[model samples]
Target: MIEEPPTTTQRSAEVERRRAGELARPLTRPAGPIAVYDTVTDGMTGWQFLRTGRWLAYTAAAILFAIICLFLANWQFDRGQQASADNAVVAANFSAEPVPIELALPTLGSYDASQNWQRVSVTGVYLANEELVVRNRSNSGTNGFEVVTPLQLSDGSVFLVDRGWVQPSPTDALNPDSIPRPTSGTVSVVVQLRPSEAPLGTGSTTGNQIQSITLPRIQQTTGGDLYTGAYGLLNSQAPAAEAGLTNTQTSMPVEDVGTHISYMVQWLFFALLGFFALGLAARKVHRELNSDDPEERERASARMRKRARKPFTDEELEDEEIDGFLPLTRWGLSSGTGTGSVAGKTVGPTAAPRVVSPAAPRMALKQDDDAGDREQGD
Candidate 1:
């Protein structure tokens, strides 16, 4: 007579006992292409893992990436430092009490970059005929020209002054509709110090229109003792220019430290993420190789099979040896050999034992068996 199949409850109880037995037994070196288990069994150390060529390549790539990130971080840090220095200079000079031009300059054509925007008082008469228009200037978003008048001091040296910006004539964009004349007599003017700009080499000066406040170039026309190093942005005059002109208001320098710090931090985190990803991948391989679960072991085996299809490198060959060997008992019904028995009970070729909790009561087991048998009959 044909023997009845074992009930689901009985199959489950058998699987639990087998799982417990497998867990209790000491792991032995597995044979075949599976090298990871063999390596673990042989007590391979962490240093040995790093010594592998694949790991060495990964480490080198991470180091290179980290070095690039650090370089960019340093560049941003330097830019932030420079911006801070510029802001400091503006803050110290923009509103300080005015000093005499003689004291501030001491020598003609000598100026300090750090003295930018410093307030200076000077008494001089405007040489209106020698005045020039600085082309391509803007004020309140209107494209215009700045009126640069030569202020001849009592000592006979001339200092250039940028009176203010004025809109070009609606009829003639090349010139102003009208230029307001500076106050005629000895005029006391308060002005901010500014370094003279470099000459724009060719086609920069034409007739009375100039492209920049380059003093030496302007001195070519005016021809006297000229302050070549610096000029002035007019603040106020005792007897200001006739009603048509307004003082040019210079914008204050911003003191904000931009997003460089944030970008620096993001790059550092990216460098760290590369190492984290490597660690996670290594852990996944370790778990898959050592797992007692047959499905997990099959997945690891599948990886090895895929790798085998490629021309093997030394590292790949080592990995292949680690993942190829699996125990017949662990494969159970899936192995197709049908040789292993679980808890002294024979399992069929197509039937894999189901795992159940060890704490299941005998009464519950009997109830489940009855239910399964009825279902099988149905």
Candidate 2:
């Protein structure tokens, strides 16, 4: 008894099974400096990705990171602009005519650049015991301290006054000789109105030395109805000792525009990088799903896998050969054959047999006759 060749249907089914098996095999890529194309192409394609919740999560995360970076960049830019404006205000009002303290002070939150470093006059009794020493203050490149004493105004409200810089004694103690003593009675004082300092959560709490002079913190610590702004004493009406004490040093806002600009550029770069990478991945998936040629898709996938391998080290380059790292070839795949069959019809490279036209045979015969005639003529 003889057995018949497998029918076309059976062959098709077998091919489908082989193709499915090949696809089901896991692809493993090593960790290293993988190419962007490899990173994009090595994942699930098209609808497979769209149908999964993981892909949505990944896309959302990328977008969120880009937005956060952009927000930080904008914040830095705004801060730079604010600094420039503050510097301008300091320059314009540093030596201007004195204004009344009430005219500069706002009824609400805090005084801004409009009042910062502006000279003002006020009559008050200095609260000697409630003074705070600003630690680690430097003047003329020498480490010293600034005494912040509160002045009790006639209206019963208190104003924190940054008196002056003072040098410590030889024993590192608060030197009475360093600080100038305020007059015994209520007196008129000329002071430069300044913005409240930033609150400090850290630094020395020992003795009278405090890290910062924020008005709110002072109000809380010293139990006083304090003014929103601080005053840097310029001069006292009452006769004062000519000590080495200097008025509060007005600080210049840092005008480092280049640093903030660089940071903005960096954040923008990160946003662009994330967006383009995501687009590349989406494009790769679209191509893989829409392509009609299965063999081409497989080859592309294999190329991506090869590119995803770990980068070669100097030692590995010297000791190991990379020639043996080839992927499984097209020759062994179901779609590898020269003749591709569909619904019992053969197609592709070997689809049709080559047949010479009758006109070609007649032309060849005429050529032979012409050769014979030429031979006779010769």
Candidate 3:
């Protein structure tokens, strides 16, 4: 047996078939960095539209954050303005003329600024027997006890007078013959005004530890008039040698804004940082959005095609057309002259299965002649 090699037409046909198959495959261009970056300048095109959508979402969120930050900044600004106003009020009141002791007493309510200032005057007489010396009183830089005395005023109204600064705790305490006390009938005194219940800025408090001369608290304990707000200093530090009464010292000034200014600064800083960061993030998203990533759309198309059950390859479509055993050449299916089915597998259409017998085929010409002769004889 001689094996025959493929002829020129057969070889050309195979080449053409291969070319057609290759042509049926879709062409795709790979992305380059320059091409990806070029999208940034193109505004919107192809995959750029998808990036634009994402950018829109980022912009919306950025705007929202910006609005929140601006609102917080404005709040801080308003707080700062309020603090400035409060400081101004304190300064103005202190600069105003000193009210007289008599008039100021009755007019304390008329001027609410008295609460913020510590030194206003009051008309009262010093008590000789009951001047109490308070410990740990500090003023300016000096440390002493606040000398407190119940003053019986000329009008019979009693006032707790805080006479300014006395010497710190005395050295000797073992065997004392006599302690100092004050002897006074009617003498003018000067004092610093302070809250009856002032906050201890620092230090630990012992349980039931006695705190020294506080006016409003003393008023609560002693049950006296709440109207009198000023305190006076005594001339002597010790209890009068004759009366054995000691002078008391107290120092209070109320013109501090405390930590409110610092709080306002912190709030403003947060607001600024928020808005700045939001803007930066938005800009980044806007830039990156123009880069390509159309994988979502490709996936969507594939899903649609899967639902429709469309053929993705030309050979598969051609095979379906030849399912009725049509001749391969007529239907553009490859004839199995170069390929053949083995067992039950169908290769090409050259060895197509059929039920009709070719050896005992009926002759169309004989049948037509027999019909014509019978008709003529009749």
Q: Please give the distance, in angstroms, between residue 348's alpha carbon in candidate 2 and its true position after superposition.
A: 23
What alpha-carbon RMSD in Å does predicted model 1 have with respect to the real structure? 12.5
Give one digit per residue, the lDDT tens place, for model 3 in 56-156: 67556766765775676566667677766656755554445544446645632232444344344555556656555554665557564555667776766
Which residue pairs overlap in candidate 2's backbone? none
Residue-level lDDT tens digits of model 1 in 1-378: 667866768666664554333322222433222435555324543335555677788888888888888888788787778778888998999999999999999887789989989999999999998888888787778888899999999999999998988888999898876888888989999999999898763664567898888888778767889998889999888975677765677577676767766776877788788788877866665554445546555565555345423443566435434443222334332233222334343444322232223334343345446866799899
Give the TM-score of each candidate.
Answer: 0.60, 0.51, 0.44
- Please report how far candidate 3 places residue 153 from its true position, in Å: 1.0
Off by over 4 Å in 3: 1-97, 107-111, 132-144, 166-183, 190-216, 224-266, 292-378
Clashes of 2: 0
lDDT of 2 by residue, 1-378 (tens): 545745657544543433223222223432112224434334544456555566687688789989998998898888778777777777777667777666766452457767677777777898887777787777778777888777888888787777788876778654333576655678677777767779765744687778877777777777756886565555545545346677655554346667777888888889888888887876666665545446655565455345424354555433323221112222122223243323233233321111112223333333434765799789
Better of 1 and 2 by lDDT: 1
Say what the RMSD of model 3 is: 24.0
